[model samples]
Target: MYRLTWFATNYDVNREVNNGRGPVDFKISKGSRDKTLVEFKLASNSKLKQNLKHQVGVYQAANNTSKSIKAILHFSQTEYLRVQNVLRDLGLSGRRDVVLIDASPKASASTVSDFNQKGFDF
Candidate 1:
């Protein structure tokens, strides 16, 4: 599981994610100055990450702004570094930067949480 690092940053207000076949997870904006392509991935399985990179490419094509897809960032900091390393080893550029951050405390966490369910932990 992973939580978004951007969410922890100071925010103006909560925003909505446009999921009409766009490349990233959600649209995060910094005031009116910048926008980002935030792609969240928890299970960096060989198959899943490979597909995500492709999705990043498509995501770039979908956006009409000049800001660029900021990053194809995976937020599973505690345990997925190896997989992230492998993905970086491939050298597929253009908005790919795997990030690591302590997982966010879930609003409603199960006492016995798996910590790998794909969101709310990173």
Candidate 2:
């Protein structure tokens, strides 16, 4: 998705890029001095806390960039709560650099009669 979004732009987006320390999920660079790292994780991952604490920092240092984004996807309310707790413990509860995506499987509003009666058309 990142690649597709930045396809016509100057930014170059690569996946699983290894810069000696380890492989980060995605690396976006416009030039040698312009770069950002993006890492994706599941809220249910066993090492969610550890990764949220140290993984992105390590990747940033390795890639020689201070900018980074961490995206986490949760499949359920339980998993979302777990992620929230971990983020709060790490003092990153509402940081913009951290994005939480709720990908839980649920009925769409368009398919719900309540939404239809409310004049919401998907």
Candidate 3:
């Protein structure tokens, strides 16, 4: 969770804002009063696949803004591939409103070499 004060000076950023449908993750208001909705997700469960298809769009309409961002963090290669496939399925793979981040720790050269020795690629 982020504190509003972190971005209040630049933009009025609030978390867990319920516009109508439900509580959105965050909403940041620009100088023109247009709100930019942001949602964060961790690729952990099966439901994430279904949620990614429409959650952000629902929040955007509820918040009365066309601009939004869905920030998804992948902690492993499996999670990363799942998100990638879901985005491609939803036709949002290259959309500007989507922000996918790789949060997995990198494998050291030694670790990669060990994997290669075992006929695996890292």
Which candidate wins on lDDT? 2
In order of listing, the candidates' clash counts read 2, 0, 0
With candidate 3 superimposed using the best TM-score fit, by how many Å does residue 117's alpha carbon deviate from the native? 21
Query: What lDDT score belongs to each candidate, Candidate 1 first?
Result: 0.50, 0.92, 0.81
Error of 3 at 21 (Å): 1.2
lDDT of 3 at 12: 77
Task: Report the lDDT tens digits of candidate 2 across residue range 35-61.
Answer: 989999999899999998998999999
Give the residue spans of candidate 1 off by over 4 A. 1-16, 30-33, 44-46, 65-81, 92-96, 102-122
* TM-score of candidate 2 to 2 decimals: 0.88
Tell me which of candidates 1 and 2 scores higher on lDDT: 2
**Per-residue lDDT for 1-109 in model 3, tens only?**
3663564377777889997899888888867558888888897867776777778789888877888888888899999888888888888888888888898988676
Q: Would you give me the overall lDDT of model 3?
A: 0.81
TM-score between model 3 and native: 0.75
Q: Rank the candidates by TM-score, best first.
A: 2, 3, 1
Q: TM-scores of all models?
A: 0.45, 0.88, 0.75
RMSD of each: 9.7, 2.2, 6.1
lDDT of 1: 0.50
> Against the true structure, whose TM-score is highest?
2
